[model samples]
Target: MKSNSHFSNSPFGKQKANKDKANSLKNLLPPLPLFILQPLLNHIVSSVAKKHPELFNRLGDSANKVFLIDPSDLPLFLILQPNPLNPTLKAYNQNEIIEHDTYICGTFATLMQMIDAQSDSDALFFNREIRVSGDSEAMVALRNALDDMEGSLAKDVAKSFGVLSKPVLLAMQKFSKNSGKENG
Candidate 1:
């Protein structure tokens, strides 16, 4: 007669193994954190602003208050104060007292990624990725400003971010080929 290993027939061991497999699967998912992304976005926005001071100037004039609300924090808006005097963008939550010039609301993840990727920010509005609930005229003004900025910066930023990459298509093709081999 031989002694059984500790985990060989233990219910707890089976549960632990299942848990470990689930954790491994979770680890395989994309790991982009919003906190890590914010600063990168702030940098990109600031850089774009610096490159084209005219746009911010126009935005400052057109927009009385600007809010950057994260969709995850629904019903609570994160107001972005664009200082005309100092010309800097500051963020504030609903609880935090601050002045806003205009509200540009979206999911922080989507907004930051769009900005960083230099894709059409207006796409968010049209595609309903970002929703604007107030001040249609102001939104239109902001859209025009973004259009101008996009004309100047989108190409360069898209190239730098590799937004035009066909990696997803390539990956799908590769996956289909592998699956065909398995079936054959």
Candidate 2:
């Protein structure tokens, strides 16, 4: 039998790659205190929500649901309440437990794929690349809302920081393209 370890397409190999990628990313991302990160998260979320009010239109009743967005490779978790009138997104340490109506777990790249609308969420879910738990209704509604939205949230997020972010975004884009990794 062929060794699964050598084939990047295999689960074992993919897990190892993800682990290496996570280590590389964690080193680059500063270990900022949650207090500092909280305000940043709040501002970004507020900016995104305000800039794209239509994102919550398909949410309907599910707009009230609390969502825990966990990037498995990261040390922080984001709890989001997609209320159009009063949206809130807060960050918490990975060790902290919080109440949420729905939970979506995936790697940073996987979540980026969703944000960029580069992948079909259902395919990702079926492929076991992304995991969803808790209220299925809310998950579906949220996915629908994301699907209905135009433009990438990533660009909007970068724009939220004003002119200063544009160069950084461009540089990151250049690096990602040259990173050799498929999802970079």
Candidate 1 C-alpha lDDT tens digits along 1-184: 1112432344323233234324543335443344554564465456666666666656755444454443332223343444444433433223333333333545444554454445577676788766554344555666666666544343343333455425533543454445334323
Model 2 TM: 0.74
Candidate 1 lands at a TM-score of 0.43
Question: Residue by residue across 1-184, what tens digits does model 2's lDDT show?
Answer: 1121223243323243334435655445655488986876787788878877888878999888888787666667788888898898887765454556676877667777776788889999999888776677888999888877788776777777787679756854654444325433
Question: Given candidate 2, what's the lDDT at residue 128?
Answer: 88
List where candidate 2 sits over 4 angstroms from the true fold: 1-32, 170-184
Model 1 C-alpha lDDT versus the unseen true structure: 0.46
Pairs that clash in candidate 2: none
Candidate 2 global Cα RMSD: 9.4
